[model samples]
Target: MKKTIQRPVVPPASVSTPVVSPIYPSVVYASDDPDGLDAQYEGGAAGYTYAREGHPNADLLARRIDALEGCSGGIVLGSGMAAVAAVLLGLCGAGDHVVGGNQLYGRSLRLMAEDLPRLGIATTLADPTDMAAVEAALRPETRLVLIEVVSNPTLRVADIEGIARLCRDRGVLLAVDNTFTTPLAVRPFALGADIVLHSVTKLLAGHSDVTLGWVAARDPDLAVRMRVFAVTTGMTPSPFDCWLAERGLATFALRFDAAQRNAAALADWLAGQAGVRRVLYPTRADHPDHNRAAALLGGQGCNMVSFEVAGGRKAANALARAADGVAFAPTLGDVGTTLSHAASSSHRALSPEARAAIGITEGFFRVSVGLEPLDALKTTFAAGLAAARDA
Candidate 1:
């Protein structure tokens, strides 16, 4: 047999393990014991029975996220919205109430505002900026209170510590969306957040190629329920997406540093520009939530910036079209700098007056600053603003 063989049949496994976590795309896991499978499903044990219930990629990613978020356990969902749905459905049911702010990511607001009520889960949208408003909205049935660390579009910074304290005193679960501010800036867990959620589609994935979400909980029981809800909902994240997200996690420090530095520069420049009406950046002393943002975020702004262009929608559109070396991306946290109109994109579902109330005006736009050089970004943005002003 050895004489007849011309070459080695199987490639040898590396002596050292691969740096990247291997992608486990297996949908089903085989086990000889039927009872073992039942046990694995009944209690989230060590082995995986199925992808929907649990998979290696999702499990590994969840563990890493749990460590990052400083939580007891974690779960991954197919999309950010899936995570939102699972949190709402897993934690609350008929007759339960949720208190959230109006300044959340539009989809999150919509989910709490429009969808939860039909499911008999009552929701109250309050002003997260006002602790009094947030406290007043809480009801006897309130199960959870949700708020974003950095409110979408308007960039309003929430007082996570105050909100968490309020929720704790009331015996309500405090869930904060840590999408905009990764653990690098601040850990919600440190501030007493009961649950932390992230749309891994943005910064966690970094490349904008993966659409995934994560939820971390301080309570192991709640984590188990969320995992079960994820399985039942059939929103198991793809293994490939999980692997990519894991890869993105490695370079996050580099990417985030560049984007944050660039964003601060751009925000400062926009504030001085004649065509700019207002710059809503935490770094600026003039921002509505500057003090809160400073106290929480260590005197630095986030990777995102929102500003009002002089010409309203017409000029904003013109600026988007006229801008060079950038794109009008509807989403954020890409390696390349991109812009989006808050009115027509993130908050499009809301009525005009409702949008205005949240400071999402027609001229308002968001910039997810990328790894571009500060000087180069300023030149291109200055030209675009001038073009928008002329338009």
Candidate 2:
């Protein structure tokens, strides 16, 4: 009070600034713009100008992801491939080259090998765990390096921080697909990734009901470019899809936590059983990248676990057919335990040689642990293992 008495009056503009919410409060649509202009073009509009550009639900989901990623901004896309395409197109042009992981999601590998080249972009696949291979694969025209936080079928954890350092020194953008680990286990941006992509159809959504994707960038400018690409390409999710994704996200942390615990237990039990050759859970000490996974993924790995059956594809098929509670499905990260044969399901798109090179064996069976009773899952797998041995 005494100080105020002696102080001179400050101008209204200089007094204080009002706080604005980081995320928009309510769902808005292109039609909601007062001027009736397209949502993206309305200069003074408080909400979305167009459905293709962005809606309130998408914006909110993006904001939530941005917060989880520790990034400046984010964009939601219609599918995981759309998010991947947006980043790749936004960052590189026709003459630029990309160095990507050899053991990536099958669709991503196909995109890099088949589609990007046709668009005049070149890509080289390298073992992300091999620093020498990565460094050697980097071309003078390389503008970006892409990798997965965890390999889909193999569960090999890439050295994200090491790769980030290499990219920073080379002045290249680092894009990481964080679909498997999700933000609950791994925050790729915080580990130095320039951009993080998520297939929200998986862990982020928790349930198998929704199909969505997102990309988050540490640099604000990059995010703007990605957003522009998304808008121009019309790779946007509907407002209803966004709402469903948001609902899925609300229980993601809880579901992932339980699923991961079940995965670890199953992995341990599987390792001790007959007819199981190898287990590929990141947290397991025998994993090649276990140390790196522990350092980056908060000690606890993800809900994905891959194992090798002793009898190759025949044994795998037998095991898949004999499994009791867990469904034999291609997709992952659902509430119910799911099993898939990588050689036939997720990696069917890859050439046999390419699949083998990435360690996707004929006997490989990938399991997505769910929030199921661990004891029951163990009993189910035990029975399947015995059946496979007999078969």
For model 1, which pairs clash? Answer: none
Query: Model 2: which ten-residue window has the lowest total lDDT?
Result: 21-30
lDDT per residue for candidate 1 within 1-391, as digits (tens), equals 3566344233477689777788887787776588877777666556877788778898788887788887757888999878887788889999999998789888888898788999999999999888889999999999998889998988999988888889999999999989899988889999999889999999888998999999988888888898888888898899999999998898998898889988988888889998888998888889898888889999768799989977777898789888888889789989998898878888888999999888888899999999988888898888889899899
TM-score against native, each model: 0.94, 0.89
- After superposition, the stretches of candidate 1 with alpha carbons farther than 4 Å from their true spots are 1-15
In candidate 1, where is summed lDDT lowest over 10 consecutive residues? 1-10
Colliding residue pairs in candidate 2: 39-49, 39-50
RMSD of each: 3.7, 9.2
Among these predictions, the greatest lDDT belongs to: 1
Model 2 CA deviation exceeding 4 Å by range: 1-42
Query: All candidates' lDDT scores?
Result: 0.87, 0.84
